[model samples]
Target: MKNLALFDLDHTLLPIDSDYEWGQFLVRIGAVDPVEFKRSNDAFFAQYQAGTLDPVEYLEFALGTLARFPRPQLDAMHAQFMREVIEPALLPQARKLLQDHLDAGDLVCIITATNRFVTAPIAKALGVEHLIAAVPEEDEHGNLTGKLLGSPTSGPGKVTHTHAWLEQIGTPLDGFGRSHFYSDSHNDIPLLSVVTHPVATNPNAALSAHATSLGWPLLQLFND
Candidate 1:
């Protein structure tokens, strides 16, 4: 049987929330009104941390940036984002964690609630081949529609998406002798509960408490 290692992209691996950083990136580039965008962005992130975020509303705010610019322009900005913002957050410990799983012949993948447009490059930069994220819809003209194409890969949705992805690849979760999931949010509890190994990396208050109760391993990849 194969071994599978799954990682959450945001606080778990990167030490910061990618979706919130993407919003800040747009504001820094003058793509949106700083005052209004920051306010909304902070609010959305707060709700996310509280485990009460409405996925649709958060996507409306985050994916809306893609619709405002052409694909080429957005791509270029994302490249800059990778260099300036995300690169610094990719700690050596996180790389080692991923490498350890790979060395053990485990298939590694990132599962994030963030939209694909924002996380795809980040995953590539981190040398991850597979990524499961919210799909941002595109229009007939190949432009972003500022909408989600399917269910958001968050909370219980992560479990659903993981099963669907496995089915598409002609492998069932049971085919894996061991399955590990590293995450930082309480929202990830549903998926974590079902995995063979559930690691809480830099967990939030709720997740920290839950992990303690469950006796799950706690990790801090960002410590300098």
Candidate 2:
């Protein structure tokens, strides 16, 4: 009877939204037009918070830059992005929480709406082996297509992808003695409802109210 631990990356383990920050990072580095990119990025982030985000449209916007740059340069840029943007957000409390799950030998996975291109390195940095993210397609030339390869791991798709991933790994959601999901948005409610322990972590107003009504546990990883 193994325990399963699932985490949402943005606003759950991290106090900030990594996807939106990555967009701002590109803007800061002059890789993209500051005015235009920021405008679209902020809009999509707002839609995400509202739980009305269309994952496909968001990915088209987010991954468009990936197609314009060569892999080597993209890799280097991401390296800088990690150091300048992500490193500071990897707070002690979040690290300790991840460590606790690892030390307990729980089957840990990060299930996020963020794309694989942006999140893979972050997952590696966090020492997480399993990630379910919106996967971008690569061409025969090994170039990004700026399109999703499968269903976006978001909203209802979170439950679908998690179940599919678990099936592939030979462990269904109910197979574990206990399953835990930590998330911050109402967008994740579908998956949260299915898990044995659903933690409203750094929850937004909607999720806070929902969790409170349901008597779910609330955790603030970034509480000062």
Candidate 3:
């Protein structure tokens, strides 16, 4: 039987939150007003940390920037963002963790609440072929619609999306003899609870306590 390794992006593989950093990147590039965008961005990030984030509202705020610009411009900006922000945030330990899974012949994948547009490239950078993330809707003209194509892969929704992805690939979760999921937030509990091995990677206070209680392995990928 095959082994499966799933990873959460923000704070797990990377040191910073990709969605929040993406907003700051847009502000730095003057694509959005710093004061206004920062206020909303900080609030959304706070809610996410507290595990009270309203996915619809946050998606509207995050994806609205894509809706305002053409794909070419957004693509260029995302490329720069990846080079300047995301690349530097990639921790050596995180890469090693992914490599360990690969070496073990596990099917590795990234499951994140961040939209596909932002995370797809990040996944490619990490050499992960499979990604399960929030899907951003596009209009008939190939422009963002500032809406989600489906339910956001967050909190309990992560489990739902994972199941859907497995079914789409003609495999069920039970097919894996040993399934591992690494995450940093308590929001991933639903998926974590289902996995055979739930490792807490650089977990927050809440997640740390929860993982401790469950005797899950705690890993700190970024010390710098």
Candidate 4:
């Protein structure tokens, strides 16, 4: 069986938070109100870093922004985000690590708490085929519905979601010869614990402490 490799998107593979950056991108482009939108965005991000994030509440705000625009406009804006914001943050070491996994014929997947709408293209750009992320609902007309369709992939849900995704793909979690999860946040500890090899990739202070205590490998993909 192929070895399973799971990577957290924000702060693990990339140095910045993609979801938060996307919000700031919108604000910078005048697509969102500068004051109130930014205030709420910063507030939610603070909660996330503090490990007290309410995924549902953040999702409501994030998805609602998507719901306000047509798919075409969102796509255009995201394309700009990729060029202006994400492109700069992409590190050679991160790309190399992903490529090494692919070369080893591992089942590489980016499992993130960010909604699929925001993270899908980023995953595609990184050349990863499979992605497990928060699901956003769409209307029959192909417009965003401003609602979450399934369990949020944060905290403990990451473990369950990974299991479900693996099962759906005909591979049980225990079936792998070796499974690995790389993450930066303590919120992903549940998933990290379940994997055979838990790597702290550019970990935050909390995760750094936890991983250090567990003797998990620390991987710093960026110089800074």
Top candidate, metric lDDT: 4
- Cα lDDT tens digits for candidate 2, 79-120: 999999899988889989999999998999999999998899
The reply for model 2, stretches above 4 Å from the true place, is: none
TM-score-better candidate, 2 vs 4? 4
lDDT of 3: 0.92
The global Cα lDDT (0 to 1) of model 4 is 0.93
Query: Candidate 2, which ten residues in sequence have the lowest lDDT sum?
Result: 141-150
Q: Model 1, which residues run further than 4 Å from truth?
A: none
Q: Give Cα distance to truth, residue 128, candidate 4, Å.
A: 0.2
User: Where is the poorest 10-residue window by lDDT in model 1?
Assistant: 56-65
TM-score of each: 0.97, 0.97, 0.97, 0.98
Better of 3 and 4 by TM-score: 4
Put down candidate 1 lDDT per residue, 1-224, tens digits, no spaces. Answer: 78999999999889888889889988998989999999999999989988899988788778876898888788889899989999999888999999999889898999999999999999998999999999999987777988889898999999999999999998888889999999999999999999999999888889989999999999877864
Go through the candidates in order and give each one's C-alpha lDDT: 0.91, 0.91, 0.92, 0.93
Q: lDDT: which is higher, 2 or 3?
A: 3
Question: For residues 170-222, could you state the per-residue lDDT of candidate 4 as single tens digits?
Answer: 99999999999999999999999999999999999999999999999998778
